[model samples]
Target: MSSALAQTLIVMPAFNEEDAVAGVVAEVRAALRGVHVLVVNDGSRDDTVGEARRAGAAVVDLPFNLGVGGAMRTGFKYARAHGFRYVVQVDSDGQHDPAGVPKILDALQTHDVAIGARFAGEGDYTVRGPRKWAMKVLAVVIGRIAGTRLTDTTSGFRGAGPRAIEIFAEHYPAEYLGDTIESLVLAARAGCTIQQVPVTMRERAGGTPSHAPVKAAVYLGRAAIALVIALWRPPLTLQPEAGTTP
Candidate 1:
């Protein structure tokens, strides 16, 4: 195992993703040799846990259904408790190519948060209507807060280094849209440096897309509220754990 791979954890928050989760986990393990992969089976009604286990991934099954944010909190806490120096969040639906994980992990060496950006000149992923507009606005706003340029602020393919991992394990948000937008705002407010790495995206191997065209307007409004709530809250502070190095 490479030293970097040994210290890093790949977290996949899966919910009813039995059809795709195993393949995604296998791809991650194969692409990043010897890196630990954890699947937070968020109360999946299907065979998510069994499939992930068969694919050589450690499984943490939640008691009940929690959205992506809640599942990720479990992941971050697991990483913190187990002394993982880095945590990368990858989608279980296979849209996030595992081949890009190493690039984000490499970026984590310099920045606290590394976002695998599909809109950053690498992928053909596109959105229309209010959703696209909301994304552009969010990129502009969150980018300023982090003191960097970001084209895909809503990207789920991201890695957090030791500092970010410590903070997130304690205060990760669990509300709707909190996993992506609010999480970025929270991290930036807490003084974590953020950077975007260009990455290619693929069609999901199974399951339906969360957002449909009919919900784009609603998504725009909800995204604005999520960002506002994140910023209105006071800055989050991290208390160092005894005898632990972040």
Candidate 2:
């Protein structure tokens, strides 16, 4: 296989997505030809693992639910171990459009990380009012901390090149923070070059959102505080091994 064909892996974190996981995996496989797909089944109570495997993705079953952060970190560790050159993170809720995978891959050629920004494009879907406000607030806070204007700090659709994959696999934040903003901010502080691309996301097709509106606001508030504290203090330094790219 060509280098581009062999080096990419789509990492999906799924929780009780038995109904949607298969379709999402198939879509990713179809959209990114020659790229492998790995689904981190976070102790799902249903048949998520079996469906993911049947849909042509390799499955990593967590012993118990570790939330999104834990599942994604597990995928990152696997990417680092297996020497993948790029890792793309997507939710299994059927909201993210897999057709945009190529755009992310293209962005990775010049950026350490490429994130899909829902607010950056002409997306028919809009975030819930409360969540939208919270995202805006968090973005401003993260921008001040990272010294850059970050538009979509709470988006889960993101791509990490080799260097970023290695760094995150080694030293990702431990606590679950709902959105991936904290990790993105930490990556920025660590001197990673991050970029964002506009992508349209559809409304979720199956399964209820893990967070309700009020719960999401509270979660974002706490995570924002944690991110500020994390920025003030230096993070644990991790050295990449020889020959590792990310």
The whole-model lDDT of each prediction reads: 0.89, 0.80
lDDT of 2 by residue, 1-246 (tens): 336647988899999999899999998788777888999999899999999999999999998998888888899999988989888887898999987777788888877778888887648757766567877888888777556667787788889887788778866665656337768767777767677888888888687697776675576567667666667667545444367443
Q: lDDT at 230 for candidate 1?
A: 91
| lDDT top scorer | 1
TM-score of 2: 0.89
Q: Lowest summed-lDDT stretch of 10 residues in model 1?
A: 237-246
TM-score of each: 0.95, 0.89
lDDT of 1 at 55: 96
For residue 35, model 2's alpha carbon misses the true position, in angstroms, by 0.9
Which parts of model 1 have CA positions greater than 4 angstroms off? 239-246
Off by over 4 Å in 2: 1-5, 216-220, 236-246
Which 10-residue window of candidate 2 scores lowest in summed lDDT? 237-246
